[model samples]
Target: MIYITGDTHGPKSIGFNSVDGVLHRFNSNNFPEQKNMTKNDYVIILGDFGCIWNVDNESSSEKNVLDWLDDKSFTTLFIDGNHENFDRLYNYPEKQWHNGKVHEIRNSVLHLMRGYVFNIDNKNIFAFGGASSHDIKDGILHPKNDLKLIKRWKHDYTKQFRILNYTYWELELPTKYEMDRGINSLKCNDFDVDFILSHSPSSSTIDILGNNNYKHDILTDYLENIKNTTKYKYWFCGHMHINKKISDKEIILYEQIIRIN
Candidate 1:
């Protein structure tokens, strides 16, 4: 079976599992619905796995999440969300897995690269993961001088308080190269895919959902192009944090976990 779910920010126990000795949540759940799945089954996370954060100093929470995922019966696959630490994630060696390129975080956990096609269970799957973080406006201010008070202030106090760039926000949108790569890959396969997986929904889907606050970004534009040109049965996304079908083909996921195959 192939299962899919929304964001899980570093496996911090969304729910408990007594069967697994109090270590189940999200894809690692010990619920009856997932009890039948074995190691052969796969669970793909849309984005925001968050296991790679603070790689310089591994926290207990991060370690616990990694250990739990490593012991899981099913393989966990994820894409790069806006909250991920790009430096750490990119350092991992990229290799081929399940007919696609992925960053092997562990033997059981994998990070799916942006703009790639994979052959899973004889189904051609197109995967793209990235989105503009809406919370960039809340980022910390960068200190203009060596003054400690200026640097430590939490609010906009003076003219020197420029919003710190690259602290909380990340460049999570897809690059032009990644966009072209995905398009070319689809062209090679005659633009046919069984499914499309992404972190953010296309602009058209967002419009249909009536979400006007989302910033117009290049990634969303690229996804809109894909929606117009690509041939796929379903497109699943996660960044919206809502459980609803934006259209007949596009679905937004949040807390609910669903089976795709």
Candidate 2:
């Protein structure tokens, strides 16, 4: 069986599992259905598996998360989300996993790259993950001097001045190259897949959902094109912290977990 869920912000406890320190929501005893799952089964995270943050030198938190995931009954797979530490995630060696290329974070944890299709349990799945963080608003503003001035005005003149910066990166959006790669890969497969998994909903999908808070960008435009052109049974995504079915084919997951296949 293949199960999919929404963003899990690392080891921080959430929902009914609030008392479990440093344990992912998936690791909680509340989800007893997972206990019956075997290694052959898969639990794919929508994105923001923040356990990989500050992975340099392997802190105790990172180790604990890794060990817990590795000990799970099923393999864990995820794609990069806006909150991920790209530097640490990119350091892992690329290898093939379940008919797609991935950065193996552990024996059972895999980071699925953008623009790839995998054959899992006799089903073809297209995975692409990334999104712009709305909280940062207008990412890294221009006029560096003005930012420094603002910092100076907020504090003593003798204090060290700091420049304002964005918490989210521009790399959170897909590049032209990545879009082309995904299109070409789909073309190679005749643009057919059973599932489309992404971190953010397509621009049109967001509009249909009436989520005015999210601004459309080049990445969302590309996904819009894919939505119009691609052939897939279902498109699952996570970013907006809400659970809704935009259409018969599109689903936005936050905390809800469901079996796909």
Candidate 3:
């Protein structure tokens, strides 16, 4: 079995400081209760691995996130998100913890992109990633509002799978720029995703964070049109920090599944 979740700003962010505690809660309550969990289980953390990759100093809260999952044997998979400093995450110096486990290890041996696929529990899942392009001026990716990241993908040909957008600037910058690529990927390449996991909610599952009136309506119409024509399964997203259900095929929280017919 595979578990999917995203939009954790990290342990040090001022507004989203309790993320570690929430991860612990989810791990303790949700991980143990699952009947399908096993040594072979894979956990897919969509993005936002850390709030700021520049903080070389370790915070106890960040350590707590590692400590909470120390004993887990599952193969954890991670991809980069916009909030995360991509270069820092990819090149951060490694250290050892008192427990003898390597600290601050980035699990991304693979680069995240639009058509990559991984097999978990006998099922094939594909991931497409897009974070705001790194700002050379400010050296930060999140809190950036320039509807200009739309040109990242040159082509989109995902074989029926899931869409996980890990960009944190969703509300302030709904990545309206990314929409054309997303829709074009689906339409031009004849690709259809069974599920989508975006860090910020788009078009209504639960986007109360931004109250994104403009993009949500656009996304809604697009997704609805796709659902009407195809046998698409579900669209699962997080970032609103609230659990919401938009329809039979869309959910606005973490850990939801859709069985393709």
Candidate 4:
């Protein structure tokens, strides 16, 4: 079996809320648990890997998270979240904090801003890391689980931002790579993305949920239009922190499948 989960923010130190410290509800232990598994199982983490960019610390959190899903020792896939720093997403440090304990100072995951494709068990899946370049003006933690937060984050027009530079990080795929890799295939008239998991949902999927009085972002409209006309199977995203489904002529938005092979 395969398991997919999201939005876990944890710190490593034995501070308050630590495994032996305070009692917490959303600690690293929240990762999915399974039994009767095999080496073929898979696990997908949508985004929001942690609260800060502490790579060494984050590794500990990840270790604990992985422990919960250890029944079959599934293969793991990670999507970079806005809260995560790109530096640690690609290059893990080679230092050790203690004997036999390694401090991983980087995140080992595919970080695609525009999008990417993956081949798994003879099935192809596409994804886009929708990490926002803007600051988290709304604070990292929210008390409300209401969809209102989702809507606010989606339509927070005031926070509109773009990629300016990323010279310090190797974790993310270059912007050029993200833009250049797909046009040809999308325009090929035959190739269609199987699954697209992005950190930020395209404005078409997210904005369309809003009242139609507002104008759409031109690029968003263009991409969605192309995907619809091109014929893709599905789109999965995490930025809004809301699980939703949108049906279009080209794709089924946010549908879950147990197996694709």
Candidate 5:
């Protein structure tokens, strides 16, 4: 079985801070369907799997949450989103799974790398995860010399501000190499895949959603190109925080867990 859903940022509360990670959606009470699942089954989060978001050392809450997830019967696969701590996520040991590269976060949890195709559960899946943060209207703050920006921002409640290397990472967008790799991978697959998974939707899909607030950059343009060229059955994305079907072949997911195959 294969299931797909949106972001589950982190635990509800890390220490004393309240969060919006929405980890509870996977619990037995909310997603009781997992009771019959096994390691052979897969639960894929589109992106923003923010359990790995702490800028510093892994907190106890994160550890507990990861362990709790590991205890689940099904395996978990995810990709990075803008909210991820790239410093931590990119450092995990790498491994090959289902013929694709991954960051081994745990025995059952894997971070699917960008620009790769994996044959899992008898299905071809093209995975690419990333998105620019749309709410940073105040712009990204630099940590060049001011180390206390986080404290100051928290105290002052700065509007729509994100700190570099701490809250915001330039890697939230795809690199040129990643784009090339994706194009090469698609060429290898003859430009066809059973599924396309990403953190952000194609620019066309954004237009379909009729939302101008979403920014268009290299990543979205790359995705738009893929959307134009690739022969895919369904494209699933997660950044919108809304659950809707943009078209017959594209979906933007959030919160709800849907059994896909």
Candidate 6:
């Protein structure tokens, strides 16, 4: 069985109402269906799997949340999102799984790399993860190698501008190489896959969703190209932070977990 859902910006002890800490979707009270699931069953988070955050190191608290998820019966697999700490995420050792490259986070936890097609349970699933963050207002500030900026926030700061490699990472968008690799990977697959897991929807999809707040960027444009060419059954995404069926085929998920046939 394969299930899909949205951004869990890390688990939170705050409460069930907080979107930032809404990992309870997998809990027995919320998703009792998982009790019957086995390790072979997969629960895929579209993006913004934020448990991998924390700049300096993998904090003990973060480890506890990850470890808790690992204890679940179903395997946990996530893709990188705009909220992730890319510096720490990319440092994980890379290996191949299900015909695609991945960062094995734990025995049953895996970080699916962008632009790879995996043969999961006899189904071809193309996974691409990334999107420009909508939270940036004043623009992203580059404080490369600046010790003072890392240690403390400015007293008179606007707080609108996200600090690069700190609050925000430019790596949230795919590089030219990553985009090309996606194209090449799809080409090798003959441009057909059972599904696509993405952080951002295609540019046309944004219009369909009536999301005018975000603009078209390199990542969305790239996704637009894929949308036009790829022969995919369903495209599942998470950036919009809403649960809606954009069409019969394209779906944007937030909290709802649905099993895919």
Please list the C-alpha lDDT of all candidates, in the order they appear: 0.74, 0.79, 0.44, 0.44, 0.86, 0.86
lDDT of 3 by residue, 1-261 (tens): 666666555643344425432264346454663344554665655555553344454457755665555445554444445465444454554443211122145442222333233334544343444333223222223322432332232143332211122232332222454455455545543454455544444443333344532244444454444445544456555544556667776665443322222
Give candidate 4 misplaced runs (Cα > 4 Å): 11-33, 55-72, 93-115, 133-174, 182-189, 211-226, 248-261
Model 1 scores a C-alpha lDDT of 0.74
lDDT of 5 by residue, 116-163 (tens): 999989999999999989988877888776556655766665567888
Mind sharing the TM-score for model 6?
A: 0.92
In model 1, the worst 10-residue window by lDDT is: 17-26
Estimate the overall C-alpha local distance difference test score of candidate 2.
0.79
Q: Pick the candidate with the highest lDDT.
A: 5
Cand. 4 Cα-lDDT: 0.44
Q: Tell me each candidate's TM-score.
A: 0.85, 0.86, 0.52, 0.56, 0.93, 0.92
lDDT of 3 at 251: 61
Superposed by TM-score, candidate 2 places the C-alpha of residue 21 at a distance from the truth, in angstroms, of 9.3
| RMSD score of candidate 1 (Å) | 4.5
Top candidate on TM-score is 5
Over 4 Å off in model 1, which ranges? 13-24, 27-30, 55-57, 138-169
Tens digit per residue, CA lDDT, model 2, 1-261: 898888887777756744322364675564667878888888888887777766245668788888888898988888888877776777888998777799988998889898889888888998898897765432344345466555544465443332222234456777888778789878877998999999988989877878667878887888898999989999999988788988899999877779999
lDDT of 4 by residue, 1-261 (tens): 445544443434245544321013223354324344345655555555453355444555455544532323454455665556565554444432211112242232223323434554444555444344334344433224434654565566775322212211233223555545555435443556555555454656656567343334433454465556655666555544444556642222221223332
Candidate 1 residues 133-180, lDDT tens each? 775443444445434654465465533322333234345777788888
Task: Count the clashes in each prediction.
Answer: 0, 0, 0, 7, 1, 0
Give per-residue lDDT, candidate 6, residue 56: 90
Measured with C-alpha atoms, the lDDT of residue 188 in candidate 2 is 77
List runs of model 6 lying over 4 Å from the truth. Answer: 13-16, 20-22, 144-159
Ranking, TM-score, top scorer first: 5, 6, 2, 1, 4, 3
Writing each residue's lDDT as its tens digit, candidate 6 over 104-146 gives: 8888889999989998878899999988888666566777765
Q: How many clashing residue pairs are found in candidate 5?
A: 1
